[model samples]
Target: MAWMYLVIGGLMEVLWAIGLKYSDGFSHPLISVLTIIGIVTSFYFFSRALKYLPVGTAYAIFTGLGAAGTAIIGMVYLGESISYIKLFFILLLISSIVGLKLNAKVEA
Candidate 1:
């Protein structure tokens, strides 16, 4: 359950990150509102996960997921450049995330 919350939070982190790109420095009214909402909602779920998960592991995974997700989305949907180096690093980050998850023991 806590892992589920963490995943949701990480996805929401992706949303808010994309939202930031579309928000245009907060000058775009509707996107800015949605981005703010995304930010709050992401934090809510992340905090829920923190209640049960190791903070160090959870936070590393959270930010790592966000960074990797955002990078992928940018390349796929936002016309951002894709390169082999980026792909390699994204894979590395994902590997590290899994490593952390496996090593961290739940409090239960």
Candidate 2:
């Protein structure tokens, strides 16, 4: 399903994003290679999902999911801050993505 692909892409986006932090500016060869693989896989799924989903809707959902998921991963795994305001915005992003997905279903 397109939604499944989109979610996988989002997860890969999060993986690469966190991996980037450990890459030491790409000096860490293993982490850098993993990061590159993650990014490529993320785009591959994203592009595949676009074949069935509208570009505007799919892209918005993809980036929103990536941003929110990556932020949560950073907070939990990387011990980044999780302020009330930041939490509120993340929730907003999730809501927006859900709304877009619902809209896309209705459109189809």
Candidate 3:
């Protein structure tokens, strides 16, 4: 359950990140509001996740997900260039996240 919260929180982080780009430095009122909401929700979920998961592991995974998701979204929707090297590093980040999860000592 904590892992779920962490993953969801990470996704929310991605959402807010993209929202920020669209918010035009908060000039777009609605987008800025929604982005703020996403940011709040992301933190809420992170707190919920911290109830069970180790702080370091959880935070690393959370930021990994957010960074990777944001990068992918930028490449796909925001006209960012897609380079093989960039993709390779993204894959490395994903692999590291998975490795951390596998090595985590989950509290029963």
Alpha-carbon local distance difference test for all models: 0.93, 0.91, 0.95
Candidate 3 TM-score over all chains jointly: 0.96
Worst 10 residues of 1 by lDDT: 99-108
Give a tens-digit lDDT track for model 3, residues 1-108.
989999999999999999999999999999999999999999999999998889999999999999999999999988999999999999999999999999987666
TM-score of each candidate? 0.97, 0.94, 0.96
Model 1 TM-score is 0.97
Q: Write the per-residue lDDT of candidate 2 for residues 72-97, one digit (tens) a residue.
A: 98888888998999999999999999
Error of 1 at 6 (Å): 0.5
Query: Candidate 3 regions off by >4 Å?
Result: none
Error of 3 at 2 (Å): 0.6
Residue pairs that clash (backbone atoms under 3 angstroms), model 1: none
How do these models rank on TM-score, best leading? 1, 3, 2
> Whose lDDT is higher: candidate 1's or candidate 3's?
3
Sort by lDDT, top down from the best: 3, 1, 2
lDDT (tens digit, per residue) of candidate 1 on 2-58: 898899999999999999989989999999999999999998999999999999999
Compare the candidates by lDDT and give the number of the best one. 3
